[model samples]
Target: MNYNREDELKFRFNQFIISKVTGENKDYYSKLTIEDFVDIKNTLSNINNIITYKTTISFMDWLRDHFSYVDENYEVYLKDVLKVKPSVNGYDIMVTGKVNIVAEIKCNKPINNGFKYGSAQKNGIIKDIQGLLEGKTKVNFNPIHAYKFLVMYDFGEHSLKATEHLIKNIPSGYRGKVEIYNDKTQLKIDKVYVVFIK
Candidate 1:
């Protein structure tokens, strides 16, 4: 899709206004006149590029903070570390316990840019599921069962539809099941989670 810088700025500005007007500092910003708000929004739009980077970083930080507690009630292993092996790619976070779960966290800027459903991204997820089904992916801990998950920062309908298409198009020989967890409020971020289980 073509990128419109002005439209992007306006969207970011609206997000900023919503956040501030509904946040702890709402009293201060909400009291400002519409003209003052527009002025502030314009000033912010001028530095939207720089603020964009900051917003991305902040989103990632928020993800880390929330996902860190995924296994709060369980005895988690490899909580904050990445596990790598010579055979398969590394995982961002591995939660090993009664129900072993390997998670790959992905942060995409703007959240609205959506995910690309090309071979690279689609095959990457497929390959991970394939590896898990074939016992090619390795983890430090052992459990009776395990699952693979791709946790990405995306809420756009296009991205979600693309993921659904990817799941439906998986080769028939694949034995595992792919499921999406769309209501993981614990994460507290706009995210789409795809899971594969054997």
Candidate 2:
């Protein structure tokens, strides 16, 4: 999509008003006044390559390294840090390239659940990105810049199959590449749409 700087600035202004009137600090720009925040959003709107495959992959690795395992978790997944503050929260990975791509991660079982919620989380992350893009938040997160949700499931052959599926399904609009982590190797599987979306 072609990003218009002026339109984004106007939208951010409106967003600021809404936050002030409704008393919602949820806008990423709630920390800054409308007048002061417009420039930040406009600057980011111009950044098109902020989200990239290498950067996103690096961010995911960082995410895995930053947080520690905890007792409050499930057999399949464990969230050491449920949220990241300041810029974004509730996302699996957050990275800054020329711009930024915030990704959320989810997993599912191939047979029983069939990666249902995992997909939902991806959608939720997209919705969140959309909201930020539309200036619904005081500060625009530039969801349109480039973003993705990871739905990872299965650990063995199924994982490979799922990765294959992901290679096929990733939308063309996604700016970055989709990667799959196998036993000890990480492959840049850009063609398939079915890696275990976790």
Candidate with top TM-score is: 1
Q: In angstroms, how far off is 11's CA in candidate 2?
A: 61
Q: What are the lDDT figures for the candidates, one per model?
A: 0.50, 0.43
Q: Write the per-residue lDDT of candidate 2 for residues 70-119, one digit (tens) a residue.
A: 11222223222233332444444434444344454333334443432357
TM-score of 1: 0.45
Which runs in model 2 stand beyond 4 Å of their true positions?
A: 1-90, 96-101, 112-139, 143-154, 169-198
The per-prediction tally of clashing pairs is 0, 27
Please provide, for model 1 over 6-72, each residue's C-alpha lDDT reduced to its tens digit, 9 standing for 90 to 100: 6685666566767856643333443567899788779767463444233333433433444554435
TM agreement with the true structure for every prediction: 0.45, 0.31
Superposed by TM-score, candidate 1 places the C-alpha of residue 71 at a distance from the truth, in angstroms, of 4.6
Q: After superposition, how far is residue 82 of candidate 2 from its true place, in Å?
A: 4.2
Q: What does the lDDT come to for candidate 2?
A: 0.43
